[model samples]
Target chain A: MSAREEVLARLRAARDVGGSTVPDVPRDYHRTGVHAPGSAAAVERLTETLTDYRATVHRVGDLDGVPAAIAAVLAGSSSVVAPPGLPGEWLGEVTATVRRDDPPLSVADLDRLDAVVTGAAVAIADTGTFVLDALAPDQGRRAISLVPDHHVCVIRAADVVSSVPEALARLAPDGPLTFVSGPSATSDIELDRVEGVHGPRRLDVVLIVPPRA
Target chain B: MTTDLGMPTVASDPHGHLRGTEPFPVAAHRALADTQLRQNLGHATRTIRAKRAAVVGEVDDWEELRRAGECVKADVMARLPELLEQLEASVTARGGVVHWARDAEEANRIVVGLVRETGSDEVVKVKSMATQETGLNEALGAAGIAALETDLAELIVQLSDDKPSHFLVPAIHRNRSEIRDIFLREMPDVDPDLTDEPRRLAMAARAHLRRKFLSARVGISGVNFAVADTGTISVVESEGNGRMCLTLPDTLITVMGVEKVVPTWSDLEVFLQLLPRSSTGERMNPYTSSWSGVTPGDGPQTFHLVLLDNGRSNVLASPDGRQALHCIRCSACLNVCPVYERTGGHAYGSIYPGPIGAVLSPQLTGIDGPDDVNASLPYASSLCGACFDACPVRIDIPHLLVQQRAAAVEAHGRPTAQDLAMRAAAAAMASPGRFSLTERVVKLGRLLSRSGRIRSVPGPGAAAWFGARDMPEPPAETFREWWGRRERS
Candidate 1:
């Protein structure tokens, strides 16, 4: 028998012998938090959680506020890269050399950039996590956000979710997803968390909340 | 670059890092003698324990989440065969080739062949417990392929030719200065002024592995969770090495234990919430990359998923023992364990260590005899029940430990001296007169002790006790006798 067949057979025998007890998955855990999605309370909680992990979060008022927010965090950056779908006006205030990822940037090309700007697919308020879908025109490829030292993620109001389950619902299984909470960190050294490692060391989240309805 | 720890043997499949060089007690004895190991383990575990407590405390529904997590894992275990088939099909539909291996040797053979086919002599790796379990790096090395461990702690262990002592931080046994020394001695073209500061050390590693990450042709990692419906593979890590290895490499080969497969994409919500908080005490880890098979032009063009069923089926066959397969390799149990805190990871002698390893390793390879090295594992725990509380999946580790201990005793065939002694003591305790007489006899040890602690006992069963610790002085009177005197008064 093929290895696959034999292995499956073994598992079947084990399940049979163990008297396959189909377990009931109790989903009573809080699927949603106290705050509603995209609510001011949710965004505030997002900011608090992101800042708690040492990521600088900027609460921007609509699309016009995004470019300045992105630029402010990229003050000392020499070069910046963003997806082709990112509005050119978003980098209008930035002095850094701009390279839009129309043609996907090589890893070596990405390494030279000081900062990366990309729009997120979804943001989770409870965990302060944002999902980056590589297939998404705004998010571009996974490497662009990762290789650069600084990552400036623009999270629009519509994209914010209240919790993890909500975030998963918004994301597709494909698109090669990356869930980033904060900048790269390691607790490997004496289990003491020191932020900054191989990934973007400085993460700046631009919250583009709409004007009060 | 593994240490020369002896392989645990059951004769059927004698591979993987499930067993250590010697029995747990003998290895633990040596581990107990090392003050440095103790201090390192003590500090690291305590630091993580506090961090975990704080983060876990933030969740109002943490217990509810744990119950969901446990039941989901149980469901996965019960229906593993079907779930695996669905996973294989989904992954195949998305342009991944699925390979199954009955044991470690087959798994290694399949991986080495894939790497050889990629024609890459070197591969960068994310920290993976599955590969470590199968000793894939050693197998790759023997096949003339250099597998560089990209995670900082794993790199330290790999560089020094040491074994991982902890699940998350492989080099938790080594202090910062020791790491600097290792880097200085081993890392070529390293800066002479590199200090023991963690950030500096992390920067040094970033500089070292950057080129390899950028250029590596093949990458190997273990799956944290494989969504059976979506065929998505997830790798959770604090450092971006996981991102580097997962994205940059053209050909990605992931070795996943069969038990890692989850039924659906939504299952990840529970795990994603449970894992980081439970493992590193983060609301969410720094990076969690999920790819369903191959993602064309975006990440690795080619992907391979090797499903390993080394000893997991054996663990699953036994109803009570099946909970061992529910482990997500969080190492939360380890960080909170008293025995693990004292002896560190090395004493368990397996790649897996701590409270989880005690029940897990022995079951992975059945206890062969009374003296089998893995047999001694069930006895390694003090069974404080902290491991159960700390476990995100709520694996009753103490229950499993006692179960494994029973299996060990049964595996011993004829009654051992300890078994006989317990049986005899039980017999005496069943009779009121004999119970009093037995208590009187136990109190006789006080006569031979000057310091009220028995240093030695001239008997067959006493050697194992006296070798490590003193026997406490018996009470002056039994409770029954004291009750009788009080009634008379």
Candidate 2:
């Protein structure tokens, strides 16, 4: 018999046997009863986790104040790359040269750009991870968020989840979800860490609080 | 490309050239003696282990996640053929092509053919064990295609022409100065005067690979997990090199082991949480890129998934041994293994070295081989259970190791002088009358010893143990002797 047939037969045989018990994967995350503790509480936990990884976290009270917040952080930068789907209202305060995430931008040009502000598809509260799908409107090409010196990912409280299982349920299988826990870092040397080896050097998470209903 | 016949075969005993009778002790002595390698391994592993612990601890459902990860893997293994067919259909529907390789030779041929068809003489590679096990780079090089390793540590090893020493951190054996020297010597157009500083070395590598990233027409990668439900493959890495390789090329060829398959996208949650923390000691990797087939004008225009089965099916056959297939290649078992800590990975003979290699290598290749290296792999471990405990999949490595040892002994035929001694021991153990007779004889010999311990004994049995360690003196009397004396009194 062919090796392929042998493997298929073995897989079938192993499956037929009831020797090993199946392990429990987390399908019922809600049964855990871990409440959100409110959006402010969730943001606080996120800030703590982000700071633990040494990333800078900032908060904006309202959407109108977002542009000013962005300007304050990127004050000296003349050019800012906005994700194609980025809300223009957030960039209203910035009077400097703004670069929209265009397809032609090379890795070198993206490196030269001042900053990028893109909305995340989901913010994992448990892991402090932000998922960016390429299809997401404001999040330009993945290279834009990855190559730039500074990345300001915008996360809304409602998108935040308490566990990885919860976050996985919200994501589409075919969609591209670039899970970013923190800025790029590596300890390839004699156990000495060097950040920004290939990705963003500075990660500035802009937590946009939902407006009071 | 035509050198398939020349590739080392199992019976040739390739790694035996580097091994000795004192395999573990010799390798461990050298590794432990190297203060630099020891310090580097210690610190690197501790940091990653700690990060994994912290991130893994954050979620109360982590145990559940681990269980889920195991179950999903088990499920896939059970329904592998059906799921693979489903996956093939899905991939084909999305304009992606699939190829099946029965073994390393077949896998290499398919990859070489694919790269040749792309008409590219060079291809960028993301770190993948499937490629390594097949010796794909060497095959590609022989085929006249330059396979460039994009992962930082892999790049260092590639530049130095060295084999990987660790699973996750391939260059764990090398220090910063070694890396700098390699960069200075091997990198084309690299500055002659480069410092051993981490930042400088990274920048130099970055500058070197940026060109490859932009110009390469074909990209080769290994997937951490393939979501059978969506026909999606996930590549997680700290460096954006993977992202570049996955996105920049027109044609992307992913070589994945059949074991990497998962039932659904939801299964990714269990592994995404398990892998990052376990391998890199991070809450999440810097980049977790998942692409399905080909994207229109965005990522690769053409995608090929090479489902590799070099020796995985053989491993999946044994009841106890099949659990070894569940390994995620996290290198957690290696880090915590006392044996691996001393010998490093090179001693294992196969591309996969360490505790996982001990059971895996022999099974992958049929056990009916004359190679001393394949025979020696099962004995490499101390059966301390440390590896099994450290394994993310919880493979009972010790159980498999013992089973492999039995298989090895059986393969070698009935009994050598050592086997006869063990058989004699079994006989003595089975009959109390013979056991007492042997005990009395041993006790009578103890009269000559000044101390309770015997410094040495004269026999073939003594040679194996006394070769490395001092033999302890025999006790003045056996527990049976004492019990007899008590009853008489």
Off by over 4 Å in 2: A1-38, A102-114, A210-213, B1-35, B191-193, B369-371, B444-452, B469-471
**What's the lDDT of the predicted structure labeled candidate 1?**
0.89
lDDT of all predictions, in order shown? 0.89, 0.74
Please list the residue runs of candidate 1 whose C-alpha ends up more than 4 Å from where it truly belongs after superposition.
Answer: B1-16, B436-440, B472-489
Predicted candidate 1 versus true structure: per-residue lDDT over B44-116, tens digit per residue = 8899999999999988999999999999999998899999999999999999999998878889999999999
User: After aligning candidate 1 to the native by TM-score, how far in Å is the CA of B231 from where it should be?
Assistant: 0.7
Q: Model 2, range B1-489, lDDT digits (tens) per residue?
A: 112332212212223322334344455556667777776767666666666666557666655666666667766666666888788877887789998776667778889999999899999999998788778888899999999998889999999988887778789878888899999899988988899888888888888887788777999999898888789889988768888788878899999988888888877877887787767666777778997877664678889999876656556556667777788888878877777776677656566778888887777765664334566788888799988766666678899889888878877644576687888889988989999888877776675454555555677777666565563455667899889899999
The candidate scoring highest on DockQ is 1
* Span of 10 residues, lowest total lDDT, candidate 1 chain B: B1-10
- TM-scores for every predicted model: 0.96, 0.91
For model 1 the local lDDT of residue B470 reads 87
Across A8-57, the per-residue lDDT of candidate 1 in tens digits comes to 88788877876698989999998876888888888888889899888998
